[model samples]
Target: MKILDRYILTSFLKTFATVFVILFFIFILQGIWLFIAELAGKDLDAWLVVKFLLFYSPNIVPLVLPLSILLASIMTFGNFAENYEFAAMKSSGISLKRAMRSLTVFIFALSIVAFFFANNVIPRAHYKFINLRKNIVQRKPAMAIVQGQFNAIGNFNIKVDKKSGENGEKLEGVTIHKRLPGATNTTVIRSKTGLLRSSENDNLLQLELFDGYYYEEITTKKPAERKKVPFAKSSFSKQVMNIDLTMLNNNDMDKEQIAHTNTMLNLKELVYTIDSLESNYSKERQSITDNITNRINLTLSKPKIINPILDKKIVDTTEVANTLAERDSVPDKLLALFDTNEDKNRLLEIASNSLNSSKFVISSGQNQVREKIKSINSHWHSLYEKFVIGFACILMFFIGAPLGAIIRKGGLGLPIVFAILIFIIFHFINTFGKKLAQENGIPPFLGAWMSSFVLSPLAILLTYRATNDIGLINMDNVLLPLQKLAQKLFKAKSKEAK
Candidate 1:
């Protein structure tokens, strides 16, 4: 390798490493804040918390990697240009493109690595992160019953004075406060002892209480009876109740319900999932249509003449004659069939009921279809997102390297400012596109790649200007209009004075 390429690559790598670490740590802190619920007061050990963060950390790389490359490239090149190293290279007959050759190769390789990382490592990490969070409460429901403090599960607030057993399932001196429906009153229960039990495969967390008393405050509407506060008391020898662990751990813990979410699947898995979702969605839509069609067909095609099951032929013949066949008078004739007002009212009532029923069916079907579309769209976005991550690396590098040369400033000052503004735009566009795509506002392909498509031209323009050593913008062209406006105002002011 030439001294120039080696020097350039080394400089970029040093800056990239520094920028990456800082960004990565900052984003990881944000992730901790996001999952603070799963970490705090859950009685998780140090190793568990570390694993949680480790699993979550890979998800942050998508946010960190591109910004790091952008900032690092800008700072490295800005420093070179600011220090006149670029000028020395130009004087030595090396072009800007030639100088960027080594770093370009590096960024391209980094992009590919980013793609595979998203396809493989990040999905696995996300799967683990979700499972760890769910399993913390699911696999160990006993953790919810902390001793000496009130712990809330569903509607029951339980406080245990002491816990002693294998897995801390036994509780002594238990107090419970339960809230009744409608927030009308509160129920207080005291037990001398209790036990919490849960099986590995069970969805219910069981609480068995021994020697407990229940007390509830009651309310009455009558003025005379309002003076004395009514109350109810009950006692039981052994009370056992089951609390759904699925609710306690959150609905996401249900493996059957959560397996199809976009974050849990890799590329191949996503392809299969998306295909299945779309197929099912189509079938469901068709089924709904067919159901409505069959209902209409049955109602319209029913036999007008009644016959006994034992008889092969109808006893009486029914005939319908068209009183008014003209299209314009068809509505009047249809209304005329209900000759009396009472019959007309009954007919209207039946028609209203049918309308409402049809409306309900259509509305429900629409909502279900929209939900399916969103799920399908989410999977599609994830499918293309694996490639987007890789392309983003190259996109950011091109943008940053040329921009740094154009601006000709280094260190944490101007380069950082430009990097932040540009990165913010990139991130915002990416998020907006993905969100819009998820809602089926645009195609998934465009949404996933919108940010890259929007910024590619800017990268090309910057690289061109930097290669030619042109200023960031044409100062003369921009200033001429402003200068003319100022002169026109001055001339008008002079004429008014005259």
Candidate 2:
């Protein structure tokens, strides 16, 4: 390597490594805050906590990569400017652009690393990190429980009877209260023997009862009731109930469960889900259409029937009027079979209500089905955002490197401050755009990449001006003209006064 090449490479590496370490520690500290919250008030071993942070490292690497690059470049070039190395190099016919060539190549390599980590390593590590957290949370009752306290596990309030390492678990005398919603009823269960066991699937606090009687009470708010309800009682032998104690006080699993979202899914899976939901929606729509058609056809194509009993009734009435209209001629059985006017009206009303209910059932089902399909369709957008926006890391470096050289100040001074402000704006816009896009106002791709698109050009413009030494805004030139004009006007006014 040439002396100049080595110089640029060394400068880039030293700055990048220093900034990367600082940012990486910040990431670890944030991860620890999250992990401690997950640990809750429960005691966990140091090794387990360390393992979680280690597993989380790859996911943090990609986000930190771009910022590290920005800071590193600014520092390297700023140092070069401050030391007059840049001026010396330019004097020897080595252009500013040529000196940066080595560092540019290094930045390109870092971009590739960012891409590889984001696409493959980070995703896999994210999955592993989630699974590891799940395992840790599900460890054992001892892991989830503090030594001396009342811990509410699932539907049961539990107190530890004894804890023995030799027995491989904690023994507890268990009391359970099961409350079902809507009714003022509660069942109380007591156990003489209980043990808390940690399994691969979940943390289990199992209860074994030699003999325990269950007591239950049901209450009602209604008054003026005629009868008293009977009380229920039950007794059991050797009852074993498994309780998930981990979820009693922790919300980590809830967040971890969201990894199943489509953002975690690859393109193929998202496509499959969308296709399946759309197909189901289509089928449901067709079914509703067919049902409506069938109902219409049934209503329109009714067959008419002649009534023999009505003809008989008319003949009988005519004969009765000829003989003695006032005489009672109808038999009870025949009269009972005849429909009264009120009865006829009621029958018509019932028929109308039945038809309306059938229509309503079909309409409600169609609406519910449509909503489900929409929900499924909305599920993939978040996954799309997380996976697609990751590509912006590489693009950010392109902009960062050029802008650093243009700014010509670094080392946590103006350049560093400028970079942070720019990144902050970029981050805010990206987040805001994502929220709007998720609600379907804008396209997902546009929202995710908007920041990079807007900032990259600004970087380029700055670089162009800096490279040609074309000043962006010459405050000296701008203010000097205004001052001279003011002086001339003031002198003219004085001459007129004289």
Candidate with top lDDT is 1
Q: Cα RMSD to native, each candidate?
A: 10.0, 12.1
lDDT tens digits, residues 141-165, model 1?
Answer: 6676778989777677889999998
TM-score of each: 0.74, 0.63
Clash pairs, candidate 2, are: 161-172, 263-383
Candidate 1: lDDT over CA atoms?
Answer: 0.86
Candidate 1: the clashing residue pairs are: none
In the range 402-435, model 2's lDDT, one tens digit per residue, is 5665556667887678667776787787787776
**Which parts of model 1 have CA positions greater than 4 angstroms off?**
139-258, 298-335, 339-342, 481-498
Q: What 10-residue stretch in candidate 2 is worst by lDDT?
A: 299-308
Off by over 4 Å in 2: 140-259, 266-394, 488-496
Going through the candidates in the order shown, the clash numbers are 0, 2
